[model samples]
Target: MPNPQLGATSLLTLLIFPDVKPDNILVDWELDEQGNQTVKEVALGDFDLSLKLIDNQPLRAPHAVGNVMWRSPEGQSGKGVAKPSDVFSFGLVCIYGLGGGDMLILDAATIKNLKDHGMPAEQEIVVRHFLYFGPLSQGLLNHVADETWHTLFTSAGSIAEEEAIDDPDARFERWPKDIAPHITPEAKDLIIKMTHLDPAERATIDEVLEHPWWSVGVHNG
Candidate 1:
């Protein structure tokens, strides 16, 4: 067998298969590097620059600085329709990489508490939080739960409001507010376009990378 080849930079990309168990999707990735210097099963870039297609859902982790990885389910018809369902999951990834709060952590906490005492709606709220705000952002946790999400959303018509006013030419401007603040106003607008509640309004991976944020960073490589 051929030995694994290393890269010029401390980076490598993996494409996970949808049917593969999340824990087992490591074949395409190299985990032997010292300190795991490269990223593990998570997003590590700012924008969705690479396009990975899988046959099943991928597990997710919360975000931190300097993480940018993204995945999407297969097509839109037949079995592929389920692929789009994975879009929601991938959306959460975008949020995390963008520095959105540890929502899965918060959601798990919320669920455990509810199991001991609250109503079903409490859990629903968190789920909705994921469905709505989970995608398109990695920093919403700081803003949404800041005792100011409502205020900010209302005032800004989503975080992109301010960003849109400034750039006027960004793509994320149309993305839903649920996940916009992690990026700059310009980036925020691009995210807005990606998270448009109407999936039709969202940007495809090909288009997303063409946005300013990715363009500025891509050349650095």
Candidate 2:
């Protein structure tokens, strides 16, 4: 039934059956209360749906209904999950979120090259500035220039400069402080660990769980 407190009213009702030729179907329902709407769980053979009702309005379009047969471990009946598929999906989501869905890290490498040359340093500086904003992929730049690693660190405060090159934890220096609130501490820790230029020194997932941000509940969600 619809919760009267939320001011919602169902205007229609529907039922679903898997064995049915059309697979999907719709039906009409009546509402006894003024402007009252409620959702009722209904099971029809291999399918399931919610039936609801709305106030006395003209009977218009039919409501949509779908079937549900199998049930997964989480009680989701439509689809099943495989361990390998789940792992693969997690990897994809991680890549998409970190790189802003952009696959061009080539620009990043180009800027690193320009910093290698002796021309005005500001040009390379601009590239490195945006690198941390997302993952950089191949062929994103207009030209190839000599760029250096130090150019990426130009914004480094004195503390960053002193420890960045030598410390395993220095990748945190890449993040701008202004966006700190937007980043959960666990995420920050993961980014720091994952972005380590020296892959050998990066922190593992188990290690990241012990980070201050994760320990304090920032990653609970």
Q: For model 2, what is the alpha-carbon lDDT of residue 185?
A: 48
Deviating ranges (above 4 Å) for candidate 1: 1-87, 103-107, 117-127, 130-182, 217-221
User: What are the C-alpha RMSDs, in order, of all predicted structures?
Assistant: 13.1, 20.9
Best by TM-score: 1
Q: Give me the runs in candidate 2 sitting further than 4 Å from their true place.
A: 1-174, 177-181, 215-221
lDDT of 2 at 131: 38
True lDDT of residue 189, candidate 1: 48
Residues 1-221, model 1: lDDT tens digits:
11222231123224322221123223334556574433323322323323354543322323111111222211111122222223333444445546554432346566577677854422333233334332334233222233333343333334443444554443333344454446455555455455443343456544554567654522222
Q: For model 2, give the 10-residue run with minimal summed lDDT.
A: 67-76
What is the alpha-carbon lDDT for the whole of candidate 1? 0.36
What TM-score, over all chains together, does every model reach? 0.38, 0.25
Tell me the tens digit of each residue's lDDT in model 2 across 131-161.
3322222211211111332333233223344
Q: CA lDDT of each candidate?
A: 0.36, 0.30
Worst 10 contiguous positions by lDDT, candidate 1: 69-78
